[model samples]
Target: MSARDLVHPLVLLRRFASDMGAAIRVGGVRGGLLATCLLAVGSLTPAYLPQSSPYWVPARALGLDSWWAKALGTGMVIAAVGLLMIAWFNVRPTIYVGVKHWAVLLWWSLPLLLAPPIFSHDAYSYAAQGWLVHNGLNPYEASPSFLPGPFADQVAWVWRYTSAPYGPLALQISHGLVELAGLNPYYSAVLHRIPALVGVALVVHFLPRIAILMNVDPRGVAWFSTINPLLVIDFVGGAHNDALMVGLVVAALYTAYRGRMFWALVLIGVGTAIKQPAILAAYPIAVIGSGWAGWHVRHLARFVVRLAYAFAVSIGVFCAISVATGLGFGWLNAVTVPGMIVTMAPFSLIGFGVQNLVNLITGDPNGQLIWKIAQTLGLVLSAAFVVWYAITRSRTRPVSFLAWAYLAFASFGPALHPWYLTWGGLLLPLSKPSPRVWRIAAALVSVLLVYDAGNMAWRNDLVGLALAAVAAAVIVLYRRYLRGHRPLAGLGYHDEEGEANA
Candidate 1:
C-alpha cells in the first residue's frame, strides 16, 4: 500500500485507542468502580501527608518522606499526562450519549475535586487571611503583620512580601466564618473550599443554559467545564478564588441573557465584590442591555432613560456594599497593584528578554531599568487590550467578551499562575472551538504545573525543559491549525452582530 493508505489506518487506530481510553477512564460499571478507588486513594493520601508536612518541601524538592506520599505524587503526574492525551485526541465516547456522558464525567471529576491542592502556596496565604479576619481585623484594611502569635508566623512571608491584591469581600466572608467557627485553622480551610465548590456547581448548572441560549450543542459542555483535569485540579483542588469569580460572572451572564437585567447586574456586582477581576463582566452586561433597549425603544430618549436607570440601580447596590464593609478605597489599589510586578505571565516575557540582554551587556545581573521598561510595556499592552475589547466587542455576548478579557489578563498579568487560566478555561468551551489551539494550551499549562511540582532541577538540568518542549509542540500545532483559520470564523453559535432575537 502507498504511504497515504498506511497513514489513514494508523490515524483510525489511534483515534479508536483514544476513545477506548477515555471511555475506560470515565464510563460504566468498571469506570465507576475505578473512580471510587481513585477518589479513596486521593482522599487518604492528603490525610497521611498534609500539605503542612515536611513532605511538601519548598521548590518541590522531593526529600526523604513517606514512600506512599511520594508514590501518590508520582501517580498524580502520570494521570495528568494521560488525561491530557485523551483530551488532545478528542477521545469522547459514543457508547453513552448526552446526559449519560455528562453523568460519567461528573463521576470521574469527584476524585479530582477531592485531590489535594498542589504547586502553589496561595491556599496557605488564603488561610492566613481567614485567620486575620477571625482575630477581629478587617482583612481588607489590615496586613497580616499586624497580627501576632502562630497566625503571624504562618503569614509572615506573605504579609511582609506580598501585596493583598485580591478583592476584600470573599476573603472577608471566609474570615467571618472562621471567626464565627471560633478561630480554627482547619475549619477555616474547609470554609475556603466552599467558594470553590460553589463555583463548580455554577459551572455545571449554568453551562447548559448558556449552551441553549447560544443554540450550541450541550453534549460537550460538562466535559469542557467539569471533567477537564485543569478545572478540577487547579480550581477545585487548589480552591482558587478565580473559580468563584468565573461562577459569578457566568451566573450574571445567564441571568442577563434571560432578560433579567436587574438581577444580572446584582449578580455581577456580587461577583466583582468577590474579586475585582469580575468587573470586566460589566462591559458585556452593559452592551447587552444597550442593544436590547435600542431594539425595543422607538426613540433614543427612551433608550437613554432606561440605560440611566439600570446604571443607577447597579452602581447604587455596589456602593452600598462598599460602604458597609468599611473597605474604603484600598480595593481599587489592589486591582491595579498586580500590573507593577514581574513574573511568569506572558506580559513578563518581554521583561525577561530585556533583563537577559541587560545582564549580558552591563554585567549587572539585576538591571532596574530593564525591569521598569518591561512593566511599562506590559501595563500598556494589557490596558490597550481591555479598552479595545470593551469598545469594539461590548455589544456581543458576554461570553465572547469574557473569553477575550481573560485571555488578555492571563497573557498580561505580572504573574501567570496555572490557576489564573482557570478563568479563561471556564469560558473557552462556550466560545469558538480552536481545538488544536486549546489542546496545546492545555497541555503546556499541565506540563508547567507538573514541572513546577517537581524539583527545580533534576540531574542538574532544569526540570522545566520538559514543559518547554510540550509548550513548543503545542505552539507549532496551533500555528498549523490557524494557517487558514479566521479568528472568529467558527464562532457559529452566536453572531458578532447579535443572535436571533428571542
Candidate 2:
C-alpha cells in the first residue's frame, strides 16, 4: 500500500524491539530463550507431518511409527509447552513488544514456513483448489480429485473429492501462486504458503499496536497471541490459510477502533474471502458503526440501514472478487458442510451425552437424529446470543461486545477444530479479557492441541499430553507468583466511565 509497507518484514520486525518497557524488556529475554526451544520443536515436526516436506528426514531417522521417535516427540512437546508457560505467565507481567518477542516469534516460526506442511494438509488441498482455478474449473463445484497430479495426491484422501469450503478470495490467492509456478501443482502447494508469512508479519505488527491502544501491556499481550505455539505451528508449520483470515480480521478491528468504519467493513469482507469465520466479524462491526446506543424507533431503523450499507459494500467486494476469478458462489453451502461433523464443543458434547443416554433407555439407537437435533438447537442458541450482544450498548471499545459474542459462538457452535480456536483467541487480547478468560483460553489451547480423533489420534494425544503438562506448569507458576505480589494493575487505565464499560 505504501513504500514504507514494502520494506522487508525482517528489518521492520527488528525495529519493533526498540523502546521496551522495563517489565517487558526483562520478560522478553525469557520469551526469547523459550522461543529457541520451540524452534527446535517446530524444526523436528516436519518429519512427523502426515506427508513429508522437503526438510523431512529419512524413515529410519524420523519414523513416526517407531516407539522411540514417539517418545522423543512426547518429550519435545512437553518441553515446548513447559518453556512457554515459564515465559508467558510464570514471571511478573512483562511488556513484551520489543525485539525480544518479535525475534522469538520469527526464530520459531520462520523455519516451519519452509518445512513441510504440519498438523493438516490443508495447504495441499488449497493448492488443488488453485489448480482447479488455473485449469478453468469452479473450485466451489469442482473437487481436487478432478485433477490428477502430485498436488492432488498431497491432499488428504477424504477431502480429495470435496469442493473447497473456503471462500473464493482464498481460491484466487492459491490460484495465483500455482499460476506463478507455471501451473506446477507441487510448487504451488509450497509457494501458496508464502502469503501466510505475510499474515504472520501482519499479526506481529498490528497486535502490539492494538494492545497499546487498549491501555494494556503490549509486550505480554502480543507475546501471548503472536508467538503462541498453536498459532506458530498451525500457521507457519501447517500453512493453514486461517492465518491470513486472522491477520485481516485483526487489522480490520484496529481500523474500526481508529474510527475508519468503512475500511473496517471492507477488510472484514476481504477476510471472509479467506475463511468463513471472519464473516462473523461483520455483525459486531456493523452494530458499532450504526451509532444506535439508545432505544428508539428511529434509532432502530438507522441501525438497520447502516448495517445494510456495510454488508452491501462488503458483499460487493466479495462479488467482485468472485466475478473476476470466475469462481462462482458455491461457497455459500461450504460453511454449512460442517453440520455433518459431531463436534466436541460444549453444546455438542451435552447433546452427545443426551443421545447416548436415550439410546440406552430405549434399547434402540437414534444417535444421529438426536445429535443433529441438539446440534441445531445449540447453533440457534449461539446465534441468538451473538445477535443480542451485537446490538447491546457498549460505553466504549466496541471490541468488547464483539469479542465476547464471537467467543461464545466458538465455544458453543457445532463446528470445532483446533485452528478455529484462533478466530476468537487472537481477538481476546484486543478486548481486554479478564484473568478468568486467560485461564480458560490456556486450558483450551492444551486440549485443542491434542483433540484429533482418528488416524494420527494417538500421536496427537502425546502432543496433547505435553501441552497439558505445560498447562499444569502455568497454573503452578501463576499461583506461586500470586503469593509474592498483589494482583496486576493493567499497564494503564482508562477514564472511570471507559473502564466501567471496557
Candidate 3:
C-alpha cells in the first residue's frame, strides 16, 4: 500500500512494455505475430461496443460504447497500431521466406475480419446495394432508406437516403450475398467481405512482383503494404471496397511488369468496375505497355498500335461486365459522392480557408460558395495532373507516376475518407517515396483513425489534441532511442542489406 510498493509495480509494467517494444523493433516474424496477437485482442473492442441489430457483436448487448469503453478501446488501438509499425519495420523477408511466411498476416487479419465494422458502415451500404441488385433495382438510382431493412438501417444517415456510390462489380457480388443470406444483414455483410479477403490475398501474392518491378525489397514492400494496422482495420475490419479495388490495381501493375499488356488491361478494367479511381492506373500502364514513354515519332506510332489493342481488350471486357450485370452508367453518379461532401481533405481545408477569408474581407459569409469554388479549383488541378501524367511519362516511371497520381487525387479530392488512403498506400510500397511523404501519410492516417466518424462522432478538437500529444511523444522517444542505440539499418524499413538478400 506504500508509495514505493505502488511505484515498484508501475516500474515493472513499464519494463514489460519496454521489452515488448524492443521485441517488435528488432525481432523477426515471431515479433510480428506477438504484435498481431495484441492487435487481435484490441480488435474485440469494436465488436463489443454497443450498436443496433445487424451490427451486433457479442458484447454489443452489454452497451459498452460508454465513455470508459471509448477511452479503453482507443488506447488499446493506439498501442496495437504503434506496435504494428515497429514489427513492420523490423520484418526480414529473407529469414521469413515464401508465401507461407507472409500468410501469417492473413491469419492475424482473420479475427478482425470477423469483428463488426469499425470505422465506416459503407459495408452496410454495400449490403443494401446488393439487396437492390437482388431485387432488380439499380443501386445508382435507389437509396437504402427507400426500402428499409436490417442492412439499410445500419448505413449512415447521409448515405442511407442516397444511392450506393460503389462499383457495379461490388454491387453484383453483394447482390449475390443478399440473395444467399436473405434479409439478414449480418450474413450479407460477411459474405460481401469475402471478396475483400480475396483482395487482401491478391495483394500479398503480387506485392513481391510489384517490388521486383520497382527493384526494391519485397519484404519491405509487403511489410509496409500488407502488415500494417491500417490495412487490417480498414480492409478486414471495415470491409471497405477499396480493398478489392486496390488489390486489383496491384495485380494489374504486376501483370504490366511482366509485359502482359492484354491481361493487365483486363485486370485494370475489372478494377475500374470495382472503383472509379482505378481507371487512372490504366493510363500509366497503357503508356508503359505501348512504349509511349519514348520521344521518337516511330515510338509514338508503336505506342498507338499497342494502346489501341489494349484499349480494345479493356473496353470489350468492361462492356461484357456491363451487359452481364445489367447495371450500366448508374455507378458513374456514385463516383461523385465524395466530392459532394466536405470532409477534412486538403481541398476541404482550402475551402474552409477561402470561406473564412471571404467572411472577413468581403462581409459575405457564404461557406458553401467558397467551398464549391475551392472544390472546382481542386478538381481542375487534379485532372490536369492526371492527364499530364498519363499522356507523357517524361522522367517518372509509369507505375511510379500512377502512384503519385493516386496521391494527388487523394490529397486534392473532396471528402477524403481514411479508407481512401489505401489507394496510395498500397502502391507506395512498390517504390520508395520520399520519407517526408511517408510522414505526411502517417499524420493523415493517424488523424483519420482518431477522428473516425462512426465511432467517435465528435467534431471537437479533442482527437486532434490527443494526436498532437501522441506525435510529440513518438518523436521524442524515437530521437532519444536513436541517440542511445545503434541506428536502424534502414530508416523506415529494417536491414536493407538483409531484405536485399531476399
Candidate 3: count the clashes.
0
Clashes of 2: 6
Q: Which pairs clash (backbone N, Cα, C closer than 3 Å) in model 3?
A: none
The stretch of ten residues in a row with the least summed lDDT in candidate 1 is 453-462
- In terms of TM-score, how similar is model 2 to the real structure? 0.80
- Model 1 misplaced regions, further than 4 Å: 1-75, 84-91, 94-102, 112-115, 148-160, 180-182, 292-315, 336-342, 356-367, 396-398, 434-497, 500-502
All models, RMSD in angstroms: 10.0, 5.1, 10.2
Backbone clashes in candidate 1 total: 0
lDDT of 1 by residue, 1-502 (tens): 6768657978768756665455555434244435334533433333223444333474156443455454554454434443443442242333234224434445555654544444344555576677766666666566667765444444425343344667667777666666765675444554565787787778768876777777765554555555555665566556778778888888887887788878887877777767767766665665554554333436446545655665666666666677776664465645545554445676576777878887999998877676666666766788798778755554454566677778777777666666677676667766655656545555555455454434221222323543554454456446645564222223344443463133
Cα-based lDDT for every prediction? 0.58, 0.65, 0.65
Candidate 3 stretches greater than 4 Å from native: 1-51, 54-65, 92-101, 356-367, 391-396, 432-502
